[model samples]
Target chain A: MAESKWTPKEPMVSAKDVHKSFGDLEVLKGVSMDVMKGDCVCVIGPSGSGKSTYIRCINALNPIDSGSIEVEGQEVNDPHLDKLELRKKVGMVFQQYNLFPHKTALENIMMAPMRVLKEPKDEVETRARELIKKVRLEGKEDSFPGELSGGQQQRVAIARSLAMRPDVMLFDEVTAALDPETVKEVLVTIRDLAEEGMTCILVTHEMGFAREVANHIYFTDRGVIVEHGPPKTFFTKAKDPRTKEFLSQIL
Target chain B: MSARTLIPGITARATTDLPVLKPFKGKPYGHDEIGFSRFLANLSPWAVVCVVMLLALWPMAAMAQAKYTIGDAFDALWKWVPFLVTKGFALNILISVTTMAIGTAAGVLLGLWQISPHPAIQKTAWAVTQAFRNSPWLVLLFIVMLAFPFEITIAGVTIPIPDWMKAVFGLSLPIMANISEVVRGAIQSVPTGQWEASESLAFSRNQTLWRIILPQCFKRMIPPWMNWYAILTMATPLVSLLGVEEIVTLSRQAMEGENNHPELLIPFYGFCLVIFFAYCYPIARWTISLERKFSVKL
Candidate 1:
């Protein structure tokens, strides 16, 4: 609350006293956090705990009822904020790979850059191919989402977000829908992104994966950060009983 | 599921006379007899039905010698075909095409308005679509015919409103309503996830609607759009009641030109039916195929 003790550099994403509700049901209850530059923050919690809702609120995908969310000094919670400009910096991939079914894998990655950013065609196409290869989908550039396997589609979705050259990336249980064998490929892609210093926030059930790739872990429960620490400390020596209980059940 | 053998060699090992393979051989018994039975098996059901219908109508064909000879009917057709094409048919097409263009443009706006976040816009769109959609097409046609000004003066110049233009305006109301429903249904059919993904990409509401949402809706909207067009085309004859010189009116005039010949009455009306069928049947087939091809999997 005083300052983000975690970061020496400026925070890329900061949420302060965020409160959100759907009708009478309040989802994010005074939730706050700081994701510094290059931080891979993994959010883990039970299903209805508002983990996904919190990350969505960061980019104004879901508006906060009260509080402030700032990304790169831009007030995301401001009503008059240029949301399109804000969103260009914060790329998100969904649990179900929401790849545009109408576009090919390359076009899916290329469209936002070309249309939204008004980037040059050749430049966008070249970058899209690079992102495709980064996500380990080199030859699948021309395949439709329906033609690809679940993992391949998810990887393409990741590449699509990366194509925007976003300052921060959000993954909402991206590999949750994949088969067990296919999960590794998607995780590997995310790990590669993290390794290359792309700031990421992941809401995941994969504790082992979170432990492996995440720099910091935020244990959320009932719309609050119940526990937060480095993954090694958080997974091994979580001080809160709720965090321990959640970890015990999951691990 | 049974584990079917994938290898052709394995299938061949089971039997020498494989039915699936037998179709490929030109001479099954080492004889060059491509029989009539095999030829008949290859024919489509539609082709067969046409042949059978001609066979059944042979007696009727022979009976046409009585009052109006086939030659006389052909003569009537020869005289009327060019007249219908040059005058009445062109108007029918103009009416259909103009109504379609205006209806579709307004319908898309109305449909998008139905989903507008603003409550007043939504309510107005709902009322407009429901009002037109619920009314009888003929009643609406009559109402437009009577309600619109017969002539208008813009500045000092007076422009007369043609009866055909009135019919087009009337037809467009119902067409617009139906198209609004089609557009609304198509947009609603898209999964919620698409909206979330597009929104997260920071696309403005207009960008999301026009670029992301509308493109996806095209596949769902097209079949019904074609279906509505065919129905609209067929209903163009209803304009004759408003005294528009469409096909039916032309047919009546052509009949009267021959002294209202009772003998030629069947042929003249039947000619209208054939023309309508010729235009509509292909559209019906095309709409069905489009429905099959672009049936939304999501």
Candidate 2:
């Protein structure tokens, strides 16, 4: 496939025919996608379709069996690739809202910047407070993860990822574990981030949220990207039978 | 007793006050009776053990000739009480504390190595932990006491290793192995999500362990660590077998000093049991409380 004629800036994240496996099971077979700067890309797939694995490969969290993933033009699969450096630029929020349970909401957001980046405490605290408010957890700065609702914890997790000042954000079904009522609050937070032009690749089951927020949509099935296009066209006029079947069941 | 008096919480006065019923009359057999029985029921196991020992020793004391009475054994015990506690038991406490400190430090490292990404380090640590964890503590104590040189020379300077110190070193080997299991279990108890979250935040593995993983494991490790300390304290008597002059050895010497009367055996040895039980029982209770307090909610 030729490069898109319209993307003026270089793709911030690019996966070229990425192949990954876990022992006997092949999770990702020649998967590829380009996430441009400030674009919201949604990857919607069935449970075993390797959507999470693909994004995890992008951040070097899981190395690919065979293929290339580059973030900001640095080869992620390189043996000598400084994963810490790659992760600094690419932030991920887990589906479980993996907030540090022992830490307060504010401290959770402040931790990476203060510890990993060695940022000054006062500066990190000030920014952390702002991010807490950005996620609309204003009065819960001191609340530990166990005390917070699932939505509140998920929002704090997003704020934690944002604390690193990352170039790209990866959301691995961040709202999947939330109560129905609380899911909107987390979605609104993500929508606000997208509107502010943060580069994002979300692997989600929330198709309605995807169509509303994502500029591009990729439908994965059976370890491959079966169809992808602009969300408007991709949702309505999916060409692949597998994509149509998946959309029919979920929608 | 009147039917009304038999009803719970009704006093004899509240029932019918009759001279014939006066014998059975007082407070109802409610709270006070339950309280007395509960007191007996809740009696410390240590106290029960002491009572049983006294009861069991009484017959032997009675069977002894008129030459040395049970009262004579008491007098001998009273004479040596201060020396036995201050010198002998103090060594036991010292050895336990020192062995625990050394074991904990070494065990934590071994535990970390057991989970190291490197196969060689992980295997070696696992083998070392298994080797010491399964070996009998007494056997290890004997090996260290007998095999280790009494002193060593380094840099033209000689440092003498005391017998008690050697006993401490021996005791620490098993303690280290057991503590290593404790540390490994504690670390593994923390969810994998923590590692992934820390990784995404760009924390190095070392940073993740010290900053994220270890702090959580610390609370989980404490109760078990204290439990091990209690076990170590009880096992300190094994050092007396090596003739390191701990409580048991001192008690034997004290009996000898009292002309080795056969009646001296009960008081001297029984005192050692009581002292050890006194020291370890509270720790066992505290460890249980700590375990409850620190148990992970999820």
Candidate 3:
């Protein structure tokens, strides 16, 4: 039994009639979705399904052609301010773990906060150390990205994202590139963030994570969200037949 | 009879005379001629090294009298070391730095200009860089000094401005080509993902550059930059032809003129060679160290 709760009633971020096209490929077609405050949405779909593309557009990584997105009470089309201010509040973690190769793990985490956020050194060091420890990258602060394993690098990337003190963290298949042994550690970190009530929109194939950690689940296909609901109801009994077919392949 | 008719007879004679020829082996596999050719080719590179070394060093060895021991050579060299360290070395270093600075700034601009969306700008920059690259450095120097103003003009101004500026232009002419190619390749080498990532951070096309593109481009670009610097250091001697009172000219004038005369021209040109070595070697070493440093981690 589906709840009769209307979606737009408690939206924190909203995209209305969004559209984007890359060359001749119309990736996002009038797609509109809203996320409530502190919501953990896991977007699951096949490759080229545009779930990753949608999450990227949430941060304006890809500008929409025709629609408007409002984030944290700011309209998408409004200009005149530096957007680093907006970006500081929205952090993104990449699939390939794009840590600065030149910097140590500690410096990688500390750099943005010190340079961008203008945090003092003592506080930066303290926070960076704590975050590194949280990601189980303890005692490896001085190591460069090349020195670390793939799992460790991804964890450092997560810590690097968290250092910005973001209001929302976008994880685009954050563990997809890691070995099976390493993926569990990164998943644990995301799970910890979810349990702590941090807002996260994750695009992942880890159905277990989508089941366990997602407060809300959105199933997208060919750039449109076909259905979305709480994890227990949606993953267990999705309303859309496409969503059912996707789950059948994965589960 | 010829051996053709007497083959069996000769064989029978040899076999009758020698017991070893009685039992022949099954087959022979490898050739000594191939092995000899391989052996010669292996030594060819080392032979080349020795020839070049003797060619370069034999002149000094001949000019070097018994009085000219390594110690005397060192003393003659060392006597001018400070004069070089201050004036001659400084001039050589200054030339390299200035050309490199001009070349890099101009190269980056021209590289972007060459790739500009505007066809006229891109074509112009490409044509100019190609001309700079193809023009021989010494020949270009002579032409720019002697014939350019007479042959070429732009807008309302004549081409040749002044002698000193001519020298600077000549030195930097080829450098523009080198730098244009370097920076163009470097910027292209960076993946589109880097630009996309910066844009994702809400940096505008321009903001993305300062925050991301140039930093990565320049850092990865250090090797070519250092190589240009070294070549520029060695090229300081070319300014002698431009009548720039640079080190090579100063040393040459010191040797030819009567004043401050040594026993022979050896002290003058010999001292100059030492100066070239002293000034250029450390910087070359520093450039190598820089390469090692930059390549170490990232």
Compute the lDDT of residue B222 as modeled in candidate 2: 79
lDDT at position A103, candidate 2 = 85
Compare the candidates by DockQ and give the number of the best one: 2
Estimate, for each residue in A1-251, the C-alpha lDDT of model 1 and write its tens digit: 12224333778898899999999999988988999999899999999999999988888888899999888878877777878888998999999988888889999898899889999999999999988888888899999899999999999989888888999999999988999999999999999889989999999999888999999999889988899999889988989999989888978
- Model 3 ranges with Cα > 4 A deviation: A1-10, A77-82, B1-98, B105-165, B187-219, B233-296
Candidates 1 and 2, the one with greater lDDT: 2
Worst 10-residue lDDT window, candidate 3 chain B: B28-37
Task: List the DockQ of the predictions in order.
Answer: 0.50, 0.56, 0.18
Evaluated with lDDT, which candidate comes out highest?
A: 2
Q: What's the true lDDT of residue B260 in model 2?
A: 87
For every model in order, what is the number of clashing pairs? 0, 0, 0
Q: Give the distance in Å from residue A233's predicted Cα in candidate 1 to where it truly belongs.
A: 2.7
Instruction: For each candidate, give its TM-score against the true structure.
Output: 0.81, 0.88, 0.68
lDDT of 1 by residue, B119-150 (tens): 99999999999999899999999999999999
DockQ for model 2? Answer: 0.56
- In Å, residue B264's CA in model 1 sits off its true spot by 6.5
How do the candidates rank by TM-score, highest first?
Answer: 2, 1, 3
